[model samples]
Target: MEIFELDKEQWKDFKLHFKWSSDKYYKVDIRKTQTGLMVELKLQTTDKPIVKDYEEPLWQQWMDEESDDEAQIFGVKIDSEIVGWMTVGMESWNNRLRVYELLVLEGYRRRGIGKLLLDKAKQIARQKNCRAIILETQTNNVNAIEFYKKQGFEFDGLDITAYHNDDVERNEVRIEMVCRNF
Candidate 1:
């Protein structure tokens, strides 16, 4: 496996297919008071896994708004084919590295490709003097959550209404995860 920086043109041809079927999801419990808010998160798996294939309309819109020119994208090439990819950019305000995307092809899953990409992202973050590597994911993506946790990421926060008016109801609540460099 070879990991290297890829240009935007190369990224344009790269296709990402995210498919997940989980019998479980992270259930969030929120407590709010006059002072602040407290949240408790836990995973609940059922007898049957609920399967959902994420459509990327919202993500596409977000990508449209965000500048890709400033992003540093790395691709994992296996036998000259891109099997995994990750993108990281500096968040100037927070002095952190925001992971825009980290994906491996379905056939490449659970083969350490994602870890390689994550490791590369960390290396880049250190080189850029960032404090942490941050990314947002949906609560329904239990597999991804486990992967993030295995990669040393912890739940930072969550936005109950990040994508739409009924985000939590729709089970698409956005949860932020962070892997601190310092």
Candidate 2:
């Protein structure tokens, strides 16, 4: 397997292995999505809330994160097909970077692919002068939570009622983790 940069143009067919894992472990509604589920960060957030609001433009805020220095997008390719990916980016004014998306394809799990991607992100985070790293996943995703813990991350906070009518899978909870450069 190899890792390379990825752009939104390549996102059309490169969705993570979420559905397959969801089917076996959890379940998918196949109708609604929680794409609009923000981190419920705080009363004053700088992201511009491109996901839920309808003021300026729809995907403008999404694209805002794609800037070169602030973020790095990588696609894991194997056998001429894209199977996994990891995106690392920094949160402005926080001195902490994060692994935005870390995923491996369905039949590609348990083969160390996810670990490789995660390690790569950590390496990059340290190189970028990040005092720490942060990432989030659903509470029900026990596998991911465990994986993050094994990688030296610790529980930082929780966002209750993160998912409701916006997603068919209601009552979903979001948990946050932080890893110091120590």
Candidate 3:
């Protein structure tokens, strides 16, 4: 397998599609305290494996004009077939590199493809003098969370209502992970 940078045209034609299954998720719990609010995330097991499938264009059309973030796309290809890719962007306002997206095909997972892509993102961050590398994943995506943790990321913060008002109830709270050492 070979990893390389993808041009705009090539990225435009690239579609990110992947499926994931998880038997565990982080349960978000929030409570009001005298001083402030208290937040907790507990690892919980699901009765059955939660599966998710997604298929979408590399870049959202709405983000084209409104987004001021500068990004680059890199893909992993094997024998002319693209199996995984990552979109890393520079947030000038924050002076950090954000991983906008990262996906590896189901069959290509566990082969260091995701790590390779993330390593590339770190390299870019260092080259650009970024303060850190940050990305988001759902609490229900335990596998992804574990992967990020293994790569030296820690839970920096979380949004209880990022996707919807009942995101916590839905067990899909948005988790912001950061690798500051990068």
The lDDT per prediction is 0.78, 0.61, 0.86
lDDT of 1 by residue, 1-182 (tens): 99998776545655556677877788777789789987777777767776766533112324434533377778899997988877777776677788888888888899999999889878877887888889998898889999999999999989988889887666668999999953
TM-score, candidate 2, is: 0.66
Which pairs of residues have clashing backbones in candidate 3?
none
Q: If both were scored by lDDT, which would come out higher, candidate 1 or candidate 3?
A: 3
lDDT of 2: 0.61
Write down the TM-score of every candidate. Answer: 0.85, 0.66, 0.93
User: Residue-wise lDDT of candidate 3 within 15-70, one digit each (tens)?
Assistant: 78867999999999999999999899999999999898888677654433433454
lDDT of 2 by residue, 93-128 (tens): 677777777777667877778777877777777777
Give Cα distance to truth, residue 5, candidate 2, Å.
1.8
lDDT of 3: 0.86
Enumerate residue pairs that collide in model 1. 23-49
| Model 3, position 113: C-alpha lDDT score | 93
In model 3, how large is the Cα lDDT of residue 96? 78
Which residue runs of candidate 2 sit more than 4 Å off their true CA positions?
12-14, 20-63, 66-68, 165-171
Better of 2 and 3 by TM-score: 3
Every model: Cα RMSD to truth = 2.9, 11.4, 1.7
